[model samples]
Target: MKVINTKIADVKIIEPSVFGDERGFFMETWNQKNFELLVSGKPTLFVQDNHSKSKKGILRGLHYQTKSTQGKLVRVIVGEVFDVAIDMREKSATFGQWVGVYLSANNKRQLWVPEGFAHGFYVTSDEAEFVYKCTDFYDPDSEISILWDDPSINIKWPLIGDPILSKKDENAIYLSDAPKLSL
Candidate 1:
């Protein structure tokens, strides 16, 4: 796998090696050693895996958990999406800044969002399937969603009008009022 770094410090776009034959194709989705070689500091242990499906124009987040419990590797499987990561690390130079990338089945690109960022995505195709691995299990109480359209951060969502959102996301805190990270 080849890792591509983004302008933001901890985000990356990973391209996996795919071998295709007459019948089909194959690729290793996740290999511990290869991942370690590309990413300098990440826990080898990932406790939970999650997947979700969304239709075009659906926006899922600007979300993150509290520190020590923050980090996820996400990718698109069946369709295309504009994946995003926003730095929330209080001490980082890019704090409150965001980055976006297009991920799809054809590209087979993966996104690595480190512990101090809020991550989200917007489905750009008729339908999209997304999957991700988290170093820590889901903790609803600990999960926090910063408003996807928070003017303070001003995410340039590639949408015409209002994008579909979950009730929880619609009620997410705006960046100005978001819980600050102590670490």
Candidate 2:
């Protein structure tokens, strides 16, 4: 596996080694020891797994938890998506900065979004099956949604049309007005 750094210090793009033939291809999506060796700093432990399917133009997230924040390792299983992560840690140098990655079944790239970041993705293909492992359990009361297009964060989404958002996402607060995360 290869770990690539993103503009944000702790965010990473992980490329796994793949073996292919005329018929198909295979790669190990996650291995605790391998990840620890490839990524810098402290080790990560994923406790919960979640998956979602979205059609083209659908957008979800820009979400983070105030307590028991989650660090996610996300990848696309069926189609393509433009995944983004924003650094929300107030004391960090890259706070408010964001990075985007293209993830698809064909490319087999995974994004590592640590705690103190809000994550969201736009489906670029007809349909996308996305899955992720989280370090922490979900906490409804601790959830916070930062608006996807907050001027302060200024995420440049790939899709042109109005994105389909959940009621929670559509009503998300701007970064300036949102609660900050502590790393």
Candidate 3:
């Protein structure tokens, strides 16, 4: 696997080594030892795995849990999407800043969003299947959503029209008003 650093040091873009032949292709998606070496250099356990599918124009986040605070390793499995991560750690140098990347089944790239960051994505294809491994269990009551188009963060979403947002996301508060991670 190869790791590429994003503007926010805690976030990373991972490219796994793919081996292909006339038949098809194979890539080791995860290996605890290898992943640990790349990140914290300590045991990192993914306690949960999640998968979601969305149609084009669907925008699903800028969300994080104030309590469970998950660190995620996410990727696209069926189509393409522009994934984003915002640093919500109050004391970090890159606090309130964000990074965006195009993740597609064709590219097979994955992104690492550490704890204390808000994550979201915009579908760029007809449809997309997104999946991720999270270090913590979901805590719906603790989940906080920040406005996808919050002016303070000013995320440059690659959109052709207004995105289709869930009611929760539509009503999300701006970064200035949202609760941030104290870490």
Candidate 4:
């Protein structure tokens, strides 16, 4: 696997080595040893897994946890998505900065979003099946959401029109009112 650095320090993109033959293909999606070797100092301990499906133009986040803060390893199991991560760590040089990655079943690329960041994604294909492993469990009380179009950190979304959002997401606070994290 190859680890690629993003504009944000805590966010990384990992490309796995695929071995394809006449039948299909195979790749080691996650290996504890390889992860430790490739991503230096990374504590690859995931205790929870989550999956979601979205139609094209649907956006699910700009979401993060405050108490049970989750560090996610995200990847698309089927279809494609435009995944993004925003650095919310107040002391970081790239605070409020963001990075995006195009992840798909075809590419087999994974994005590692450590704690102290907000994560989101838009379905770029007709439909996308997204799955991720989190270092922490889902704690609704600790979860926070940032408005997807907050002016302070205007994210260039690949939306055709108004992307579908949950009621909670539609009511998310803007960055100006959102809480900051200390890494």
Give me the candidate number with maximum lDDT: 3
TM-score, cand. 2 vs. native: 0.97
Screening candidate 4 with a backbone cut-off below 3 angstroms (N, C-alpha, C), the clashing residue pairs are none
Q: Rank the candidates by TM-score, best first.
A: 3, 2, 4, 1
For all predictions, the C-alpha RMSD in Å is 1.4, 0.9, 0.8, 1.0
Candidate with maximal TM-score: 3
lDDT of 2 by residue, 1-183 (tens): 888998877999999999999999989998988787776467878899999999999999889999999999999999999999998898899988999999999999999998889999999999999999999999989999999988888899997699999999999999998788767
lDDT for predicted candidate 1 compared with the true structure:
0.85
Worst 10 residues of 4 by lDDT: 35-44
The reply for model 4, stretches above 4 Å from the true place, is none
Superposed by TM-score, candidate 2 places the C-alpha of residue 180 at a distance from the truth, in angstroms, of: 1.0
lDDT of 2 at 122: 97
Could you estimate the TM-score for every candidate? 0.94, 0.97, 0.98, 0.96
Candidate 4 accuracy as TM-score: 0.96
Steric overlap count per candidate: 0, 0, 0, 0
Which digits, one per residue and each the tens of the lDDT, describe model 3 over residues 1-183? 999988888899999999999999999999999999986466899999999999999999989999999999999999999999999998889999999999999999999998999999999999999999999999999999999998888899999899999999999988998787898
Considering summed lDDT, which 10 consecutive residues are worst modelled in model 1?
Answer: 36-45
Cα miss at 29, model 1 (Å)?
Answer: 0.9
